[model samples]
Target: MPLGADHLIHANVVCSDFERSLDFYTRLLGARVIGEVFEFDAGEDFMTILGVTGGARCRAALLTWSDDDTATYLDLLAFADGGGHAARTAKDTGLARLGLRVRDLAAALAWIEEHGVPVVGGPVTLTPMPGRQRHVVTIRDPDGTLLTLMEFPERR
Candidate 1:
């Protein structure tokens, strides 16, 4: 029998600044904090799971797009000694971006601009099939993680 998959649990984002990322995702992206933020030092099991060496401390919080208990959330993490950043681009070999579906692309763009976040790419339209139109744009969070906001105007 094939292994069945139900749904995604969450996506992990290692942040350069925990507070800044928390504010950006919550205030600008409309995600609400699922619980209080917590901090902990990496234990043996944690280090092994994350594939890291040496001692490390981290702070984390869960953010959800809605109030639904089963909704996918963002696992925002910040390491105390995380060192330098690489600056991810769309062409990066690993995970490059996260896609968010918005109700109105125009309104979302306007709100993001009003909050002083610049659009890094596209307000381009995609017609994947007949009568199916999508508008998408790219923006970066405080930690330079690209988020692709897409709007599907209609269902065909």
Candidate 2:
């Protein structure tokens, strides 16, 4: 029999400003720094793999959780020479938008509002996956990147 996967390994995100992204992940999201890599060694390799040019001067950072609770790791990347394209709007595109699971949807929305982030959608119920329930709220970050904060009280 095939073995069942325990957890997700990692997720990669390309950012325009490496420092700002790192700060957002570390400060706002509470992610800890696991490792960092300079450009000269793995920059060219990454650019080639990503099908991009002039990214040899970029920087990469690997971040992990504080505990081994079987959570997905995040790879924060910045391209010094060749910045990637900006994130598309949710109305016009179907792309990646970071999802954060919070305990209280209303409290989280309040905190996010106080922080000056604009809320796109309401604290509404979504039944996209049958038999699964998710209370979600959408917001836009400083870079206009859409993010969803979900509360899974039913799951708990």
The number of the candidate with the highest lDDT is 1
Which lDDT tens digits does candidate 2 get at residues 1-156?
A: 878977667877767777887776676656787755444545566668978654455577777655663457777766556555765777665555778787788787787777676788888989877888889998865566777889887766
Candidate 2 whole-model C-alpha lDDT, 0 to 1: 0.71
Which ten contiguous residues of candidate 2 have the minimum total lDDT? 35-44
> Which whole-number lDDT from 0 to 100 does residue 119 have in model 2?
81
lDDT tens digits, residue span 1-156, model 1: 877988888999999988989999988899988868899997878888878877689999899987795699999999998867889899999989999999999999999999999899989999888878899999999889999999988831
The alpha-carbon root-mean-square deviation between model 2 and the true structure, to one decimal in Å, is 3.6
TM-score list, all predictions:
0.91, 0.74
**Alpha-carbon RMSD, candidate 1:** 1.8
